[model samples]
Target: MRVSSLLRFRSTSLQTSIAKQQQYVPQHKPAVQDDIKRLEDFLISKPNILVLSGAGISTESGIPDYRSEGVGLYARTNHKPIQHLEFVKSSSVRKRYWARNFVGWPNFSSTQPNATHHALARFEREMRVQAVVTQNVDRLHTKAGSRNIVELHGSGYVVKCLSCEYRIDRHEFQTILATLNPAFKDAPDMIRPDGDVEIPVDYIENFHIPECPECGGNLKPEIVFFGDCVPRPRLDKIAEMVYNSDGLLVLGSSLLVFSGYRMVLQMKDLKLPVAIVNIGDTRADHLADIKISAKCGDVIPKLFDFRKTNPL
Candidate 1:
């Protein structure tokens, strides 16, 4: 199906689901004190907890998520991101991808970490958190002072040569792009969460793409695109962290992707307690020992504050 058709279908399906829920479901309720206490107790019991975060965590910092109801990228547009195979095989695809990225880079790069990120960093500093494994490519965790982190998807701040070991900083590459395509330097500011923007095909066709200066190779972002595999070494490292940690605490993720969902499944296999903090239903909701439907920014700071006042 065409991208537009797919998006329209999804939008219609989502609208129908929302209408049905409005008719059948009761009004939303605020988080209860008992739920907060349960989460706090879980944290106190497991100091060496591994945190699994996803796009929802970064939404508070002004980056849009891919799957949030009525506000996600899927619900808002029909732009399908470049697939890994298409990028490797087609120069036309590469040209269009880089063009959109050029326009979106500034705003995407300027986003700062929010309260949830800072609270997680504090947890790491206090030795209460074992490590953080995130599915986001924005590097907000690193920016927030999180020392121990495993980025499930690689960072978007670096670009690598396909045929050589050469790497270039994305910001520096942006300067090169501006130099190559001066006409596009002043392009309208439209940014996406994945560092891509909407650009007309005619404009994209005129955009100049750069090759690896060091080896004349194709350049691509360091992110793990769809249809690409996460490096086995990274997976092994995350598995080790899960094995060593006392329990798992998921923050702001729906766990729709199998990669992030697998961690929750691993915790279940080990019979370790799992607690989730998200605004909606997650894939592992049934498996979680404690599930609190709330925003991570609101819940995490309160959790840390609760810990300070009532130390276990």
Candidate 2:
């Protein structure tokens, strides 16, 4: 079956299974303001904090995250992301990947930073936040004017030549793609969490992929794919930042991916205080000194006392 058809079938099967299963609704309890206070106190105590963020931070800006309770990509569908090996090994895989990216890039690039991003930027300015290491490839932190940032997963806005190491702006490449694949200029409007959209298998078959203008080599987005490893230099920089900071603050991440979760383990080894602010349960809840189960947009703005009265 085609990739899109397979995904749709899986989604149908999942929904049918869920509908047939007996659901148990959990009891709702009123939220405690003390949790917020504790988070505030934790931030106040740590003069230099290293913030590790994830996709959850960008959800407020209308970008879908990967692992939220009812809204994440996994929760909604069974479509898996492209692995590094597949992408590098097969031309057909490259065509399909770029085709989806071609359809999704417009909306993905146009997304603006939300309140959570602004709040983090403000914290950086106040010297409370030393640096931010984010698992997201959206570049929202940079857009929000946060200077010290480490993009654990590289940005989607950059395209690099696999052979010559030449890089070009993603937007520029998008124009090239449109010119080459005029037939695919009007692809479906379904955008995925990772800036990829769903395209029919027929569209994938006819999609024209462009080669690097410099070396006529394969071009790929400079992101860490599922089967790819994070660069050692980036890991070393993050470790240095964590070591220099007084404590670690996790914002909107479940810590499911070991790349971000390993930081929590390192902090535990160092005996540094760790504070987590996320909507759902995280893998490192037990290691956190303070866990605030709330939306980052709702709680992050309240953590700091700004002069602007209308700050939200």
Candidate 3:
């Protein structure tokens, strides 16, 4: 009769259509129905819900994620990273890494947060999501309007002088890097999604790894390098929120990294239920109470409607 009523009618008709399709499915999807109810009930209860997000949440924003075959960020930025220690010890490694990052900054910073990011932002606004703990350095979760976010890894938008510890904005550092590595100017190199590049070996060997203009310390991107540990304060912040929250929601993480995997273990210790909406078997698959093998784009939007107690 009216727009609102018409929309509701269409919703009912769609449910009927889905129910009919369910009847044709070979296996009964009782679990699917149950999961939807659990999700809705949990949200309706308004328990503090903590988010543990990975790259998958940002994939829809045109930002590449890791592990989704054609959609993964790593597959695009397949260049192997030189370890922080190695870079520090070998001038060659530092020069090469920084040179590549300098060229890649524009593309990386230009990426905007996507639907899944916006959905999480909405959840926070709706008071359904209390906090976010993420492994991504892109800072998308915060960009999405998540107020309380603990970044287990460092942010890509920052670079610090190894000696001075002065954090400079990534763009400012890129200009400094460009001035120092002039050999890479107009040089042909392959660019990748994660803001990394493939370049000639000699270019790095001769390039100077500059000192901090303010403090005379060696310069480095602030991101948590492979083999580096996340600071204790960051870990404590996540633990505090998780302990207080009613449930945990993991999005798009494979959990190959220990920082994220540890959160699953923490939930186990707290006896709090963990629900995962990832595309693959993460290290926490056995730990999660509800595992949705779907993309974040699909799962997060539907979470607005799904619940735990649907009357048969």
lDDT of 2 at 129: 84
Residue range with the least summed lDDT across 10 consecutive positions in model 1 = 20-29
Worst ten-residue run, lDDT, model 3? Answer: 21-30
Candidate 3: tens digits of C-alpha lDDT, residues 1-312:
999999999999978755532221122122254565566666667558888898766655545554556435445556564576886787667777776776667766776676678778788887888988888888887777778788888899888887765788888777776787777676435563233467667766776666777878777777788877788888898888878988888888888889899888988898888888776678889888888776666557666743533635
Identify the leading candidate in terms of lDDT.
1
- Judge candidate 3 against the unseen true structure and give its global Cα lDDT, from 0 to 1: 0.72
Q: 42-126 in candidate 2: lDDT tens per residue?
A: 8888889899998878876767776666656666676567899999999999998898788888878988887789988999998
**Cα-based TM-score, every candidate:** 0.86, 0.85, 0.79
On TM-score, the stronger of 1 and 3 is 1
RMSD of each: 10.0, 9.3, 9.1
Model 3, clash count?
8
- Supply candidate 1's per-residue lDDT for 218: 96
Angstrom error of the Cα, residue 4, model 3: value is: 34
